[model samples]
Each structure stands twice: as structure tokens, then as C-alpha cells.
Target chain A: MKKYSDRDSLLIFIVLIFFFILFIKLMYLQIILHVKIDRVVKKMVTKNNIENSKRGDILDIKGNILATSVKQYIIFLDSKIIKDLNKIKMILFKYGIKIKEQKITEFKEKSYIPIAYNVNIDIANKIRSQKLEGVGFDVRYTRHHPEGKFLTHILGITDCCGNGLEGIEKKYNKYLLGSKIVTRMYRDGYGHIIMQDKLVDQSKMCGQNVILSIDRNIQFIAEQELRKAFDKYNAKKAICIIQNPKNGGILAMVSLPDFDFSNRIKNLKILRNSAISDVYEPGSTFKIVTIAAALDMGKIKCSDSFYLENGKLKLGGHIIRDNHKINGTVSLSKIMEISSNIGIIKIAQKLVKKEFYDYIKKFGFHSLTGIDLIGESKGILMNLKYWNHLTLPTISFGQGIAVTPIQMLSAFSIIANDGVFKKPYVVQEIRKVNNKITFNILDNQKLGKRVVSYETAQIIKKLLRNVVESGTGKNAKVNGYSVAGKTGTAQKFDHKTKSYSTKFYTVSFCGMLPVINPKLVILVIIDEPKSNNYYAAAVAAPVFANIAKRTAEYLGIKKDKYEIV
Target chain B: MYKYFLLIILIILSIFIYLWQQNTSIRFAYKVSNLQTKYNKISIENDLLKLKINSLLALEKMYSIADRNGLMRPDGNNVVYLN
Candidate 1:
């Protein structure tokens, strides 16, 4: 009986000891480890969701959509529960989606796996309908150009990550790429943004929409005419710009050879916007700069006479000859009308070197035009101290100096704008998602800087008008519009020959309509024309005429001449 | 003693109602979460469709099609001014 009692006591003591150990473990788990366990549970239940803000839309002045973003989905899978991997592959393959078979299978335990990216909405819908248990989708944005291949260089292309890489896309990337948002959402086992709380403002995620001053119709017209000439001449490159003279708004800009932004580009050269990126000798088109400077400085006048030296001027051991020779004495108007190189050289000789350099700077040459485009090239200009005997006369005739297409257009626009230089820009306005103006450039402010007097600009305009009316720019003359312009045919410099190449030429035409009070300024340039005629009057003027005519008609520009009073 | 037994039963009934209400609230929250997800997806789909429509109606595409069909733009002489 004593041994039985002792055994019972021992058993009781062992049972109590086991209960105490269990109680201690319960206390540790419920108190000390409680916070840690709660965190783990929350992490399992909550999803770290990243909602991408939609990139802003690019719209023309008329609210025409040029570029936009569409919601695309990346199809993913949880290989853990993929019942019948072959079945999933079969459905995906039906919709033209090809996925690597071995990758998902190898990572069978991965909760989230990417199957395909940028699956279009139509196919994504078809995929969601399948209701495959483990398959999932994550949303993303794909940049879409509504205008297709048109304005490729202007609107530029976004990379796979929806970041702008060139042109306006790069220039306004910060403004266009809205803020990305991250939300720790409490999702129900399956990962998703729990919208029940409505905590995140999706609208704040969107970048600002850019409203460009570009007129789509005008851009199309310029692109069409420029492309026609480019193909006809088999030119290496071509550029055209249409600007509003009154306010310096760039209405249309076309550069070719251009690439389709929607397609993957192989050659990066096609992405360059040549209108602002490339520089070439203005040739005869640069004569306007000489005239404007001469007239502005009271050094020369339309009525002033210059001895052509029989159309050949011997200066600095180099005999400079004119394209069209005029013997004896000729008026400044005649010099411009005939596009005589000697005549312009004689005029440039009248202005001092310092005066010439100052005028060039005033005309917005040798510096950026601030045209709201990236990669603007400041044309080559020699320092005044480096000017030799031949530099002045040579530069006067649009040789030995370089100017971009946009710079030459601005010079012409100053004359049309009553001698006031307005900074050229393409972006008219930038609005936030809520339609509030963030950056507004479409103000009524005119005359960014006074380049020359109104009287001097008028005299230059008159001479330019005569050049178009009955001069070398006759092909550029639009019917009943009173055009004013200059044509350029510059020899491209050959690095191999260390001089200008005879075979390669850059033909250009920069002009404005209704010279009396111009509204539009248009410029066209063709590089390395392989056609029989490489003259600016032949290759570039006709293109200018065609584009200007179409643009005027589209914009309802009134006929200034041949109207019955 | 019988009254106290009745009171205990009443208390048990009230506790059961309270628990049922809490359960209903949780179920409603789940429904709300699901509805929110569906709404977001639909909105995205709607935006995508709108973008597609705009692309299809782009002027450049229309012009290309018109050119293919031998349609030439009318000259300035043919266009009558309305204003």
C-alpha cells in the first residue's frame, strides 16, 4: 500500500510538470512573439501594389490626339497550383502568345511569375475569361501614337518602360511621366488593389497632358509635300517648318527620313529631328540676314547701288562669282531678285566686322533659338578676331557660315513679324490631370525681343517680295498671296576633300505669305539631292509652294492680291 | 431561481446576435473588396477601348486609306468658304 501511494504521487508530479511547461510556451507565444506573428500574418494578407500613373496625352492645338497611353496587362502565373501546365500553355498559344515551357515549371513554387508582357486588352480579356486558377495579371502602360508614323520625330518614342527617349518625349519627360504610387493594400489572399478604402488618388498618378501649338492638318501637308520631294530627289535628308509669324508658334515641323515610333527602331539616325538638330550653310537664303543687317544699320538701302565688278569680284586672291551675273551697277532689290553672290558680297563689305557679328547674334544665330526642342544645334560662327579678309564676303553670300533650318525660319519670321523676334515654341500648354494649367505658353505676349526696326523689316520684306514675284524664288510664289522669300543652294563641305563637294548640295527655301502683313512662315530644305536639278528653286521651292498652298487653304488665309475691289 | 435561469438565457441570446452582426460586417467587407477590384478592371478596359477608337479614327490613318483609294484633296478653287 505504501509503494502504490508513492507511485501515484510521482505520476501526479510528472503530470503537473508537463502542464507547467505547456503553459510557459503558451505565454511566450501569446505575449512575447505576438507582435512578430501579427506582422507575419499582415504580410501574408497584404500586397505591396504599385499602380503606374498613366502617361499624359500629347494633343495638337485643336485638341487632336497625337500620342497617348493604353492600359496593357502582363500575364503571370503561380506555378504552385498550375493544374495541367500543358493546358495553360495550350490556351496561351491559342491567342498567339508563346511562353517558355521550362521556366515556369522549374520555379514551381514561385507565387508570382511573369508569363507575357504587354498583352493587348482584347487578348487580356480573352485570357481572363479562361479563369485558370493560378494564372494572374498585372497592369502596365504601353505608349501609343494615334497618328501612326506621322510626326515620328516630333512626338518621339518611349522605351519599353514607358519613358520618353527623344524629341518632345524627352524634352518634357518629367512633365509627362506622372508620379508612380505604391500602396500597401490589404488584399484577400489573392493579390489586388483593395479599392474599398479609396485611399490612393489615381488621378494624382497621371502626368500632365501637353497641348502643342502644332496644327495636325498643317503638319500633314508639310510632311506630304516634303516626303514627295524627298522621294523624288532621293535626298539623304529633308526638313520643313511652318510657324506663325505673329506669335512665333511652330505650327508644323517635318523631318525625314523618320522612323515609325510604334515599331522597334534599328538605326538611331532616323530618330534625329533635323530641323533643329542639323546645321547647313544658308547659301542665298542667308542673303536676307545681310540685307536686314545692312538696312538696320543704315549702311545700305534698297535704293543704294553697288558695282558688281561684272558679276565677278576678285578679293583676297579668290575670284568670287555670282550664280546670276549683273554687269556694272545694280540696285539692292535687283541683287536679291537675281540672287547674285557678288552683289551680296559687295553689300556685306559696307558693314563693319563688329557690326556684322552683332547683327548675326541679334538674328539668333550662333546660339540656341530656345524653340522648346531638344538637341538644338548652335550653328558654327567664327570669332570676330578670327575673321580674315575672305570670311566677311564669303559669309555674306551664305557660305563659310552655318545656320539651322529653325534659325533661318526665325530670321524670316522677324521680318514678317514687323522686326520683332518671338521665341519659337511647339508646346502651347501643359495641363495637369485635373485640367489645371501647369505650364502655359500660349499667352498673348508678342515681340520676345526687337531684332530690327519696323521700317528696316518692311524694306527687307519688299525686296524679298520682289525676289518671289519675279526672281529666283519664282517657283515659291503662291497665287495671290504676295509671298516674300529667299532660295538657297549651298554646296556641302566634304571632309575628305577639305573643301565644298561639287556633287552634294543642300537646297532650301524660307519664306512667308502676304508679305505686307505676314501670318505664316514656311521653310523647306533638301539635303544631297540626286535628281538632275539640285537647285533650291527647283527641288525645294516647288515643295514650299505645294505645302504653303495647302496650309493657307486649310487655315482659311485670305488672298491678299488679285481680289476684285 | 427560475427567473435567474431566464435572465441567463436572454443574455446568451444577446451575445449570439452580437456575434452574428460582427460576422455580417466582415462578409460585407469582403464583398466590397471584390466589387472594388472588378470596378477598377472595368475602368481600365474602358480606357483601353477608348484609346483604340481614337487610334482608329486618327486623321493620318484615314488619309492613307483615302490616298490608296485614289482620292485627291480638293484644290483651293473647289473649296467654298462658309464664313
Candidate 2:
């Protein structure tokens, strides 16, 4: 053993004291203050990032893309992190982006500055690959409607945040809007970020898709033919709808004066789907309801006769006249064939006022058709208590009553569908992001109520056939198909005059082809045609004929009438 | 003495394995982050290409093209159907 001197002993004691102080400091940092220090480090190195999921698409029945979201980027700059500004400028310039010198100087003073918008994915990738410091990108999705001016009212438009604003887009917004995800990212000293966990599958987080019942080809045909007539007549507005009578699925619906949704809408009123929103007196078309009701209730027989008073009569101090003159007693079929106002009034008198109102409601009037659209009017139907002496008579001829074109078409569809009233719908199915169908129209089809007896429907079908064969709707006849329908020419009610206008008229025609087993129920309406001839027979019937002929040929329906070889 | 030496070696080996696992996990995280970014870029590119295809097949464009090419709709009398 060696003995230590006084100076060496002091040195050893001092070293031991220094080591005791170091141990105490390490204990404080590792135990008592560990939570606080760890929190500070995480705050500096970790960031919260919100990832937006892509919105779902809108497709037609044939799986054609009608509306979709395309990924776009907002190229931005963070002046604090940006190094080598000239290098970024040179690279962006190569991609046809010119940044001003003044803007660059101003950007340095601000932390975040958006440099470019709607930068496509390719250009964004190229800029990102350059690894220019301080350059950042914000992901955005833009809603694009590629079929311009086609199905404008149906496809609708979206806001800047990709929310649907109108039409089908508004009605099915929830299913079309996808969920957003939040993630935490860890950043290193070099500014590179690594996710804390595996990224969630983006498609699984996306919104479900909406599939419509509208066929693009049929829509094109209807739009083309109706546009020609609309331009020729210089009408205020025109609407056409073709529906499948069996299931009440709308094949095509066109409302003219349609604005391209991609462009800013100046007049929002045109955005209204006039097919189901605007109401007008259906004129002779309403006569079908009166006649069908009378026939169904056993108020009259097919062979029953009514006196026509030489095509004119007076009721409730108002004189009504028919366009064609007929004398003495005429058969029930002839009354509908010539659209005799007096004959229809006499037939309506068989039913009480309450009975007529009930039938009208049963035909889906005075209520929403329950269409999958946002803005639909239930139409103007006065309550039964509001009926005066003239109400029943005038409504019987479609003068006092008001209905939307869709309602009138649906009413006629009741006869075509063997008296069963089916609700009309445009959305056919809703599918998940995984292509699994979640909701299908066929799966949820409602067994429609029977509005009239099947026997009565068949008889009314025959009467409508006669109207197109040799009566007012003769212009609606196709060459090889037996047709059934009615023509309507209603005078516009003037608010200023407080009476019907003689100069302005709304002419319309509703018809079905192959009358035995009708495939398509079509309605064409021309409002305020600026022509000398504004009769429904002349204006609306011909348009209906062109659409029917072409549609029939396109659908390849077996010809009902065969010529002898 | 030999038992004590073996115990010390085992403790040292366990620490080494733990450190190696921690380092390897971080490296794998970085690789996975790169792959996720690549996948997102490709998905965006695919969406853009689909939109392009739809734009090309728009009905109005096709109609005008057909009209310019002197194509006419065939009349019912001129068409023959085969079963």
C-alpha cells in the first residue's frame, strides 16, 4: 500500500466531488424533466398534415363519365425554407411559368406565398423532382364536366370546395363527398418528412359514386330534335322528356335555354329544371283523366253517346267551343278524337266535384312525383272546397287546372302502364368506391298503386290510338308503329290582364309508340311559339313524331306494322 | 468465474440486437414513405388520363366530326335487321 501526501489527497477528494455534481445533473434530466424536454423536441420535429380524399364521380347509366374530379396542385413557396430562389425560378420558367422579379422580392417578406394555381400533375412532379428548397405544393381537386352543354341541368355544378350546388349533384352530395384524413409526419434536419404509420388506402376513403338512369344516346337524340324545333319557332322555352312506361325511369330529359355549367351562370332562373318545376294548364291532355275516371266508374260505356250541341255550348255563363264541328249525338271515342270541350264537360258532370278531385290526386297531381331532384313544384291544384260552378267544367277540359309537364306525362303513363302509377326516378344506382352496388332502383322498386282498372286502361289506350290515327294527333304517327297520344294547346294566363292571352300559347303533345305494349312515353312542350301556327297538332306533334321515329329506330323495337312483301 | 463471463456476454449481445432493430425500423419507415409518395403521384396521373379519354369521346365532338365527314343518319326504309 502507498501512503498519500496531503496535496494528492486533496486532488482525489476534488475529483470525487466533481463526479458527484455530474451524476446529479444527469438524474434531473433523465427523470424529473424528461417529459417536458421530450414534448419540446416532438413539437419541433413533428407536424400535423391533413390529406383530402378525392370526391366520387357521376356516371350515366351506360357507365360514361359525366362528372369527375381531377387532381390539381397549388404550387407555393415558403420563404423561410427556400434556398436558391434563382434555381427554382429557372426550373418553373422551363415549364412556361413566368415569375416576376417584383413578386419574388415580395415573396421573401411573406412566409407562405402561392405562386401558381391549377398546376397539372405532370408539371408538379417535374418541379418536385428538381428538389428546389422552399418549394411546396398544396393538393386540390377540380370538378370537371367534359360533356359541355349536355345534361347541364342534370349534371349540375360544384363550388370551389367541390360541393355540389344544384340538380343531381345537390341531391346526392353526401354520397358524392368523400371523407378527409389527418396524418402526423416526422421531419428530419434535412426537411424530409416520414409518415408515422402506413398510409390509408385513398380509394377506400373516397365518396361513393352515383349512377343515373339517363341514357346519353337517347338524351342526344331528344336534345337534337327539340333544339331544331325550339330554334325554328323561336320559343321562350322548350322541354322534352322520354320515360320508360314499364319502370318509370327517365331515359332523356331536355330543357332548352340550357346554360353550360362550366361557364359562370348569369341567370340562375334557367337552372330550374322546368320539366318538373313550371306549371301550365295541360289543355286537352287533362281530358284523358276525365274520360278515364268516367269509364272506370261505369259512368259511361264505350258505346255511349253524348250530344255535341253543334260544337258549342254554354256553362256557368262561359261559352266553350270545339276546334272541329260535330252535330247531334257522337260516340264516346269521337268526343276524345276531336277534343270536344262540350263533350268532355258533359262526361265530367257524371262525376261529382269530390270524385274528380280524388281522381286527379290519384293520377299524381297536386303532389310531388317524388323525383330525385331538388326543386320540384307540386303544381297548382285548388282544393275541392275552392271549386265553383265553373271549376269542374273548366278543369275537365284542362283550362282551370295546372300541371307540370312531368305530371302530365305521368298521368298519360298511367294509361300506358295498364293503370298502375309508377314513380319517376333518374338515379339508377349508388355504388361504393370498390365497385359494389349499395343501392339499386330495381332492388327497391315500389309496387305502384292501381289508378284505374286494367280494362279501363286498355279502352283509353284505344281512344288515344284513334286520336293519333285520324284525329288531332295525326301528325304524331310514325310510319311503321301504331301510336297513341293527345295534343294540347293551352292559352297562357296573363297576370296583367287577369285573363287568358290569345296571342301567347303553350303547345304540347304526349304520346307512346306501339300502343299495344308501349315502350316509350314521350312528352314535348313548346312555350310561347312566335309563329302564326301555334297549334299543338302543328308545332308539338311534329317534333314528337321526329323524336319517336328516330328513338324507335335507335332502340330497334320490332316493327308493329309490316308491309306486304 | 466462467459462468460470470458468459452472463456478461449474453447481456452485451441483447443490447446489440435491440439497437440493430431500432435502426433497421427507421430505415424501413423512410423507404415506405418514399413508396407511398410514388403511389400517390401515379394515382393522380391515372385520374388525369381517364378524364382525357372521356373528353375525347364526348358526344358533341363526335357528332360534329361525323357531320364534317359527310355521315348521314340511315333511314328506317334503308336499314335491314338480322336476327
Clashing pairs in model 1? none
Q: lDDT by residue for model 1 over A119-221, one digit each (tens)?
A: 8777888889999878898778888777788888889888877898898889999999988878666665565534334456566789899999999889988
Q: Could you report the Cα RMSD, in angstroms, for every candidate shown?
A: 3.7, 3.1
lDDT of 2 by residue, B40-83 (tens): 88898899899889988988889999999999889899989896
What TM-score does prediction 1 earn? 0.91
Clashes of each: 0, 0
lDDT of each: 0.87, 0.90
Off by over 4 Å in 2: A1-19, A76-116, A129-136, A563-565, B1-13
Q: What is the interface RMSD of candidate 1, in Å?
A: 2.6
